[model samples]
Structure formats: C-alpha cells, structure tokens
Target: MSVPILKQGEILIASIQSALSDRELVELRDELADRVGRLRSRGVVIDVTALDVLDSFATRTIRGIAYTAKLRGAKTVVVGIQPEVAFAMVQLGLSLDGIATALDLEEGMLLLQRWPK
Candidate 1:
C-alpha cells in the first residue's frame, strides 16, 4: 500500500499504516526524498509503528531515506519502532547507525525541533 506523507509546517511526516512490499518501500524512500526538496522541509519523521517486521531491505531503505534527506538539508527521525522489531534487528545484525530515532511521533518531532538547522 502507498504510504501517506503529511506535511506539518517545516517537517514532513510519513506514517506507515501497514506492512509494505519492497517496491513500495522504495517508493516511499523516493517520494520522501522528492518531497523534502520540493517542500523545502527542515525535517522528516517516519513512523513505522504498525510494522511488525523489518527485513534487511526495509532497514536499508529507512536508513537510505534518512541519509538522503540529510543530504538534501533536512534531518530525519524514525519513530515507533516496536520492542520486538528492535530485538529482531539486533538479532539479525541490522543497525540504524548514524540515523536519528525516537520512541514515538511526539518525541521524533521534539528531536527534530531541538536539532540545529
């Protein structure tokens, strides 16, 4: 399913409501990249609370989104990563190194707000 990206002031928020296929995940990465530039956003928050699993591809894609947005002059924070997902990622040797993350959307927004532009 296509994820809905909402623009909130100078930040863009993409809340994933369901599990997405690989292609859809890539589409999200691309779309967020484009929107960051087009909208001149200062930050981005991607909420993946609904996702129960994050395979290598999904993990990589999220990291890519953060990096790409950073290069485009916007900070990115991933939020809503469940406890199970975090454990699974560690077990699978997956990491979101150098990427910012928060426990939920509200915290994600606060992080972005606190960071220097």
Candidate 2:
C-alpha cells in the first residue's frame, strides 16, 4: 500500500505505517521527489516506527531516498526506528551512513528546522 505524505510548512512528513514491497518503496521515492520539487519543500521526515523489520533492500531504498532528496535541495531525516530494528540494522551492517536520524518525529522535525539552509 502507498504511504501518506503530508506537508507541514516547509517540511514533508511521510509516515510508513505498513510493510511495503520494494516496488512500493521505489514509487514512494519518486513521489517524494516530485512533491519536494513541486512544493519547494526544504526538508523531509520519514517515520518508520511502525515497521517491525527493515531488510537490506528497504534500507538501501531509504538511503536512496535521502540522497535523492538532498540532491533536490531538501534534507531528509529518518525517525521512529525501534530498538530491535536498529539492532538488526547494525548487525547486518546496514548503517544508514550519512542520513540523519531522530528518536521520534518531533525530534526529526526539530532537526530539519535547525539544519542550515
């Protein structure tokens, strides 16, 4: 299923509330890119707290999304990562290198706001 992306001021928030297939993640990446450009948003927050698992493909897709958003002049913050998911990602060496992360959505938004323009 598609995720809901909402805009709050100059930031776009995408809450991933379910397990998405690789194809769905790709679609999400494209949609976010389009929306960022159209809305002239300066930042994006992706909430993945609901996700119980994050595999290699999903991790890579998220990284790609962050990088793509950066190229479009938007900073990306990934938030709401559960402890178990974080452990699994670390064990698998899926360190989301270079991507900013926050403990929760609130902190994520704050990070985006504090980020230099």
Candidate 2's residue-wise lDDT over 12-95, tens digit each? 999998989899999999999999999999999999999999999999999999999999999999999999999999999998
lDDT of 2 at 106: 99
TM-score of each: 0.98, 0.98
| Model 1 steric clash pairs | none
Query: Which has the greatest lDDT?
Result: 1
> Candidate 1 at residue 59, lDDT?
98
How many clashes does each candidate structure show, in the order listed? Answer: 0, 0
lDDT of 1 at 29: 92
Candidate 2 — which pairs collide?
none
Model 1 per-residue lDDT at 38: 98
